[model samples]
Target: MAFEQSLRRPVAATIRMIVPAGGAKPAPPVGPALGQYRLNLMTFCKDFNARTQHIKPETPMSVLLTAYKDNTFDFIVKSPSVTWYLKKAAGIQAGSGKPGHETVATLSVKHIYEIAKIKQTDPNCQTMPLESICKSIISTARTMGIKVLKELD
Candidate 1:
């Protein structure tokens, strides 16, 4: 709590104006530039575990990864995270497998709101109000001349 609130350090900021995409060449990043994006990704990983540590131990382990080109989310697990949520957040449900064969699942996000809502319950997520996070990241990436090939929608 003290770390979250009381600790304060200088957050340097600089403004760089650039034409929007499909216009003139983009401007270079300002401030710490790409560091913020990396930090955010790392933060998301850490926060997810901390917030769910108690429930997660009893819950099964799973690996979550994304396919960048396809804009799809994938998970591989002997036991699914969904089953853990069903048991922990909802009323009791039957445990399907003490140890099941590893399975991988992938899904596309045709509707972004659906994913945003799902993100709320993500154990590894620290980002609430994803809209702003998305905007900042996209803007930063654009300014840095990084391509975003996938659409969340």
Candidate 2:
């Protein structure tokens, strides 16, 4: 037991990035980001691509990587951002430039609730209450110039 415990190394650093689904490559961002840590870039690219294969190609995915002292690393892939989901549900390409002054799209409260449910599945949000998650989603929608309505009229 002691020998096994000794083999475990503490996390040396954490890196976060938004990578396109199934689009990991040993170039530019991925290369530079992990290169400094002396991580095996090709291995990361291959593993990331394989793990994200089920998602649609080109969909943006958020990933968190933990590098240990011995150069070994682990990572977790999170679902897309709330902003992305909002745009999809509202059928908009982008948020309004003047969020408060102009509205780009309107979303129903039901939509907000649904998004909250999706977000709640994320590890970071698992401990948060559903009502709080819904509120946060509403706030994000507001900032994106998406008016949240009680019902579609």
Best by TM-score: 2
Off by over 4 Å in 2: 1-8
lDDT of 1 by residue, 1-153 (tens): 878655443333322221112221112321133243232333333443454454435344443333222222222222233333333322334432322232122122222233345444545444567675344433433333333334523
- For all predicted structures, in order, the TM-scores are 0.19, 0.89
Q: Tens digits of per-residue lDDT for model 2 on 35-59?
A: 8888999999999999999999998
* Residue 34 lDDT in candidate 1: 23
Model 2, residue 68: distance off in Å is 1.6
Provide the clash count, candidate 1.
2
Local distance difference test, per candidate? 0.34, 0.92
**Model 1 misplaced regions, further than 4 Å:** 1-56, 64-80, 95-118, 121-153
Model 1, residue 7: what's the lDDT? Answer: 48
**Residue 126 in model 2: lDDT:** 96
Candidates in order: C-alpha RMSD to true structure: 20.4, 2.1
